[model samples]
Target chain A: MPRFNAIFFKLALNSLKSRQGSVILTLLAIIVSVYVLIGVEQIRMQTKQNFNSTIAGTDLIVGARTGDINLLLYAVFHMGAATQNISWKTYQELTTLSSVEWAVPISLGDSHQGYRVTATTPDYFTHYHYAELQPLQFAAGQPFEDVYDVVLGSEVAHKLGYQLGDKLTLSHGLGATSFSVHKDKPFRISGLLQATGTPVDKSLYISLSAMEAIHIGWNNGANSNAAHSVIDTQSLTPKSVTAVMLGLKQKTAIFRFQRVVNEYRDEALLAILPGVTLAKLWQITSVMEQSLRLIAVLILISSLLGLVAMLLASIRERQHEIAVMRVMGASPWFIFSLIEIEVVIVTFVGYVFGLLGVAMSFELAKNIGLEHFSIHLSSNIFSIDQLIYLALILIAAMIAGLIPAVMAYKQALGVRLD
Target chain B: MKTSILIQNLKFSYSPQSPLILDIPSWHVEQGERLFLQGPSGCGKSSLLNLISGILPLTQGYLGVLGAQLDTLSGRQRDHFRAQRIGYVFQRFNLIPYLSALDNIRLACIFTDQQQDSKQVEDKACSLLISLGIEQSHWHKASHQLSVGQQQRVAIARAMIHQPQLLIVDEPTSSLDHQSRDAFMQLLLRQVESTPLTLLFVSHDHTLSSYFSRSQSMNEINDA
Candidate 1:
């Protein structure tokens, strides 16, 4: 039986070699679809992981009444303008509560060359966490010391070509082409944070006093003339904060504390469970994954149909060669098995080529995903699911091969060798 | 003495509704006898060969080859019997065009139940190619790249590689001119004489019968 298989393998190879052009073209289709399927799956998983790890360690986020995802998008991600700011008196009162261990007030609504500028106390760095409570680490220098000292996120420093002691003025608003620059109170880069593969990588951190000093003369979102305003950082205080991230002293008191802030008598403040809100944001990103998978599945179906078409057409051209073999002592089963094995070989080879291509392309995507989106895209060559896909591709290929195999078998049995 | 073929009241038709294509009252060929049968095209010559080779079913006949009744054997058994004891050289010399001459000959050994080491199969192929006047230069070339004469020799070598007992040559020299035809006939006669080969050479050309040990017309025996 093994010897018969050996002979059949050679015969199949001879047949494929005779039609190398069509065989290679069919293989290319399989390779491309495989690559696309694996690529989309990897990117989907990476994006999910990135979105999930964006906020951690904070039990509740206190913002003005807004949507859960909206609060998360603006407060944690610095994506949009907050509709209302939390009163400083309310933040101070919230910190005094026995259930609150720490409250880090964050102020946004400023930009420096497209990077959001976040004004917060040094406590923000000590308590803030991401990716399983992973603490923020500095790549160079310490956190801000003087009011004019600023700390740059890893991406911000790397992208803007800034080093410690380089001074940069903040823009009045969040636009990249802002004309209202706060040139009077320029802040020097005091530190640089390590790349965390999260939203923190694209932010500029500074003390709340600096934000107040920069906007001292600004009115109605415009930088006022400096002729009468030389206010010192010590004399000004942040009038309001965009949101406050709270960590509970007792994890069990989180619900009670959130209720106290949500129904506070002084203002219309909203407190949300960060975990639940981040999950809501993740739903939007998952839609991207579904669309990509749908496209990949469509491509896979087309390629498989193409594979079946090529094999069926080849069977018509191979009737003469098969008749010759049947007379040369090859049985009908031999001819049938040859066609099946030929398709299997093509699928296996195309799968390997596609896998290699995916690995190479993802190697580049990993870096791009990190630098641009702060998403840690893994470049794992062959995950278990990918192996399952490989098995499925081969099985589908064998099933597709059966149609042509039956045709060839019938021809072999019916051919007249005269 | 064992008979190579025995037939009595054999009848064959493509389907039940069609007229019989082959009808023979009685026929026999002793073992080791060389029989050359000639007939015009479409005269049931190919049908008779198909029945003798067990390619067609025999439901109403006492057809036997080498003491085994072909009518009693199943389809698969007949296929194995043909592959084991019969080698056929077709009219068109249908060698796999892409395979080398040696590989084409080795394909015969692949279908047999007998196992041969690679060295043994290679040795046999080399000897057959050499004896059949296939030179070293042409043996390594692809079957299609060889001249018509070389391809014919390769096909014969392939058919004889398993050393089948009954060798059937169907219009082996129909494509050749007189000079090359004489050369091929000389080579085929010389090769078969050395083995205990029962040759059944079929062709319409009667001039070649002078070289065969036995000669008869297929239509004379087949009454349809």
Candidate 2:
């Protein structure tokens, strides 16, 4: 039976070989469609995963009364400028609450090169987690202990070629090409954080005291005046901070802690669950994702239609071939299955090549995306959803091929009679 | 003598609304006999052969081929019967254009589930190709690449490879010149010499009738 099946398979292979021009064109259409379909799906899934994995273990992000997504963007992603900063006293008061197990205050607004400088305490290294509660392991040196010491994210250290003990001064503003550089007090690179494949890889970490010491004489977001006190590291204390990340001892107390922070008597603060806010952000951006998916499916459907058309067009030319097979004792079902087998073979090969193309393009996109956009695309290429999509494509191609298969079957039967 | 084909009150047409194109009242051919059926174009000679081979459905008649009543068999059964017991050769483009000459011969036995060794089938195919004068080098080339005479010879090999009980040759010599036609007929006749193969050769040309033992014109049998 296997040998008998081999004959038909060989015939189909030879038939396709004879008609390489149209076959390759059909294959190219299928390949492009599959590539687009899988590529868009990969980006959508990877983007959502990358966003969801940026921060974890921290229960609530408390910022000075802003939209949830805006707070997340500024506090965790460092994407936009913070409109208001919560007083440092509010953060201290929140830490003293019974439900708040630990709190790490983050003061933003200083930049070295293009990387943001996050001002936080050493407690941040112990409390903060990302991507399934993975702790922040330092690749070199310890967390910032001195007011003049600075720790660099893996990206910043690697991109700027900064090693331990390298001194770089921070800019006053957040822009990449800031002119208001603090020339007097330069901080040494005390530590380098290992890559976490998150936004944590793109920031420089410094103590809150360093943040206040650097802005000692700055009046209105400008360079210091001539009479500014020279390097007062001992008496420095931060008055305000951009946001704070809190981790509770009990998971059930998250909502209560969030409510307590939101209705604080001293300041107008907003506490947001990182996961819920991320989901909300995705919901807002899901329309574009859905549209991309629709376009990919449409392309795949049209390409499958093209395959059907190609087979339909070839059936007429193969009338004599079908007649010969019929005379050689092939049933109408044989003719029907021949066309189907051809379609399956074409689609399967196209799918294989499309997968290869996806892998190659992802490899190329991974580097560029990480360098320019700081978007870490995961390397795990094939997933269950992708396999399901492939199965759907095969089934769709089979269904589309039926149009021509039925026509050929009818034609073969007609040839035998007439 | 065992009858290879028997037809009585046989009728065929393209559709129920159309007039009958073949109305053969009675006809029979004995096993191991070579019968030449000569006719001009559109005389329903091919249609008569189609009915006898179970290629066309029998609407009204008693039709039998190789001792089996074809009219009583289902379409699928007839297909299986043809695959195991019949060999058919078309006039032109008899071979699949892309398959090799050897592969074309092997195609004849593809549908049958006979427990034959593949090595044996391949050896028989090779010997048949060699006997039909198809060169060993040309055996693997695409059938379309062969010359017309060579292709006709390969078609004869393909038809005879499965050793069917009934061999139907429909104007197989129409495309060949006189010499190649004679050569094709000589190889075809030699293949059926020792076997109980009932040869039904159909053609519009009359010159080739001398090669068969019996001859009949379309007007003598089919009354349309």
Candidate 3:
């Protein structure tokens, strides 16, 4: 290799080695900031990925007239309150659309503790797809085959400590508060679905007729309620549902079918594209994302400021050393370059360690998050935003060192050879 | 004798509004001249040496070293000239604490772009240490690990390693005891005698000036 400017590099290396403790401390501060930045970014990206993948293979979510965001909140995630509920007749009419390939009705109203209770058909387990079009897989037993049979998601089972053949009653509303449970008829846990790292992980799945069956004894016996009250397992009927998920035969006809469902005068219904509604949800949360990004940047700035302060504080102690180097023929610029080079080296090392920390954090989060919120952490760490963040860190570190570097240069200029 | 350093009507002030610290109407030193410039504390002896070496830009008048005008050179050019032609030994014997004595000596050669074989440089540095009465065992020790007297010897080795035309010694004996000071001055003068290097030894001890062929007091050089 060609000879380096030894006066430059040697001074930098020697200065760093002489103040090894302070240099290491500064490097550690940078590493911590980088770790936090990458950590927050990884969670944000993975959260979005998890949200988008929560309900795949569904072309449209048809529900009561509401904004696309509210429709998605209630229909798919079972979050927030429903603005409206589609009647059973509207769901039937949507199922009859020529463009519809398969339609799965969902009724959401109750909860088993914090986990939402979703009432749907067997097709939810058979035809439903999540991330990468992967259909739901049972980690324990089979999907619900009877009206009063229920399938608990992995999180719901793990959190509530429920097992196959366990019987549980649903609470009246979706909130955490529970006044009464449908204790007269409890649903038996027929299966536990594998963790999908989505809302599905936090929901209880039962047949629509089972939901209707639980409410059958109320309201003085309407025929619709009376029909679902019969304990003769084969004699129940689901009179109404909250919403329906539809997959189209031809994706090109999604808008046409959505319009068809929206024009249904029989009930106040709305058809929302899951992808479009996901984008809307992202918009609603964009402010939070921006604020988080800003906080990460501010933390990085503070870390760099700490680095600058540390380096500047050491400048006084190194003044004699710098004067010695100056007498040895090293220029003021050489000293400046030396300080800058140290910062760059530390920054590069911190960035590498930060990326490693992010990867490790993601691995840890993957396991815990799946068991908790069903959000899968992605393995890709070098996203464009992360690269930009790394670049910003480098620039910021260099800028931080500039203060000490300029001071060193000025001191060197006035240095006397006494 | 060839003029190694020449100062003409040179004046320096710490600030534009401050009183003049040094005002040398004229001074000249020949090659191989061991001139002991003696003065008490606050007498601007160090400031004059700084101006001759071009570490401090002359505020007024001209200075020439080895036939090159220092004031005409840019900061970078002046630094290169200083590295190539001048060596300095400070009062504290300021050697980088982490570096071995040999490495510290080699740093001078490295900066001057005067490549020397490590074995040859090590042999020369060790020989200098031995000549200075330092033991062989302390040659490879870090500068800080060595005693203050030993570190002063190492600083002398570093200043002489590159064999520059001018050697500036700044009160190297100030911090030494009487016996150590006498021994250090003897060893330092012997080394300077072996090389054709001009010596500008600044000190407050006028008794030490009798050893030099030429001597001047700062009181005589500056009217202050």
Candidate 4:
């Protein structure tokens, strides 16, 4: 067997050298498929990591009765629409829970040109944490204390090109198409938060009372029989809020506190553990993730089939070569092993190239995606998922190569000296 | 002396639609015997050699080579028997184009578990090439770089490198010119005489048969 292996190695090496062009082309196909697989995996892992870390230090998110995914979407990502609003009385009652250390109420359902407008108290700036459990730090000015003061997230300021003391108007709805803006009640940008590469980087922060004050005039306008009216900021009275972010006194009592908040009789409100909600969101998205993984596996399988076809197609042209080897005392197994070794070599080369391709893509994404999307592509190469992908590629290649190896063995067995 | 190859009533057909091409009643080559078998193209000369070397299975009769019954052995066992005992040299296009002459010779050694010194093999290959009138400079060149005559000599060296008990030559001198063909034949006969290996040289040209101890035609054997 060792003697046969020596012959197999020499033959496989010589055959690959002779057919360098076809071998390289087949390898290139494998490399492209492997690159796509690893690239998608990296993006998926990093995006999930970014989403999980978007609001790490916050313990619970209080909102109206909804699914955990919906709660996470509105509270953490500021995506989609909130189904219901929590009354002022319910918010005040939740703060009195035994496990509630500090609670910051937030109001949503407003926008400033694609950026979400969040209304909360001064505690938002003091308590909100992002990646690495780091508190929000000011880039220029202080938090929004006055009713007309607005604190902008780093991306909001950079994208809108707003600076300190720059006056801005708010829109009534959460979309970019909001027609009614608070033209008469413009707010000055009081501060800019440093970039955190989280959803917070795209928010416009103001006081909850400010959000209520803006809607106060509209509430009275509905009774006065006007279609819609923009109220002066000074003439409005603050009322309701959208949701609240709760920080627990003890991490162990999060579930107990959530149960108490959910049973609130004053309003139909819900309190959710942010981590649990985020995990539920991940579960919902895992279907799409699994589909993406399946597609990647299919691509890898097709590439390996391409390898087998490439080898099998070349076998006819190499029959004389096989016959020569057989006459020289090489067994059929030797020929089969020769073909198998060629595929193994090609797969190994392709795997290396695939890794390099993924690394290069991440480097490109870090420079561009992080600046714009606030998503940092991690540079770690030894991720367990990636190792699994590599192992999968190897196993798939071995299985794929078996077809041609068997064909070679059969051909060698049938060879005749005549 | 032990018979290196013995065949009784061997029958073979190329395809199911075709009639039998080889129908030999009986044939035998003794050990150390150099027999020349002459037959025209398409007369199943190569088929006969394939059957004798255990490459092609006998359909109708028994074949025994080196004391092993070819018909009783499995395909794998036949391959093993051929590898361990029989050596074959083709008419032309014998050497692999990518491998050097020495590597071509060393390929045969790769099948056996016996330990062989690379230096001794190299020296033997060099001497074989020298004896076959192949220059030392031409030994390292790829098979395609050498002339037809030089390639035939390399093929001979490859076939005889392992000193197999039986050697089968398939019209090896057909591509050589008259002078080179005579010289190739002389070198081949001298090598066979030096070793106890049986030689079966197949060709259509009967003029070369006078040099061998015995010569026979396919018509005399097969009555085709």
The TM-score-based order of candidates, best leading, equals 2, 1, 3, 4
All candidates: TM-score: 0.88, 0.93, 0.87, 0.85
Candidate 4 C-alpha error for residue B149, in Å: 2.8
lDDT of 3 by residue, A1-418 (tens): 1135554466567667778898888888888888888888778888887788877889988888888788888887788878567777777777886888999988888788877999998998877888789999999999888888999988889888999999998887776777666767789999999888778888999888788777766654222334443475554567677888899999999888888888877877788988888977888788999899889878888888888888888888887778888888878887787778888877888888888988887877777766655667766687787778777788889988899999988988888766
lDDT of each: 0.85, 0.87, 0.82, 0.82
> Candidate 2, clashing residue pairs?
none
In the range B115-187, model 4's lDDT, one tens digit per residue, is 6787787788888888888888887776779988888888889888877888999988888899999998988
Once fitted onto the true fold, the runs of candidate 2 whose alpha carbons sit more than 4 angstroms away are: A1-4, A137-141, A155-163, A176-183, A219-234, A263-266, A416-418
Please name the candidate that would achieve the greatest DockQ relative to the true structure: 2
Report chain B TM per candidate: 0.96, 0.97, 0.94, 0.93
lDDT of 1 at A102: 92
Off by over 4 Å in 4: A1-7, A66-68, A81-84, A122-127, A130-150, A163-191, A207-239, A282-295, A379-382, A398-403, B8-26, B60-62, B117-142, B189-193, B219-224
Clashes counted in candidate 4 amount to 0
What C-alpha lDDT, on a 0 to 100 scale, does residue B71 get in candidate 3? 77
lDDT of 1 by residue, A86-196 (tens): 888988988898888899999998899989999999998898898889989989999898989999999999899999889999897888988888877789899999998
RMSD to native, candidate 3: 3.8
TM-score of 3: 0.87
Report the lDDT of model 4 for residue A396: 82
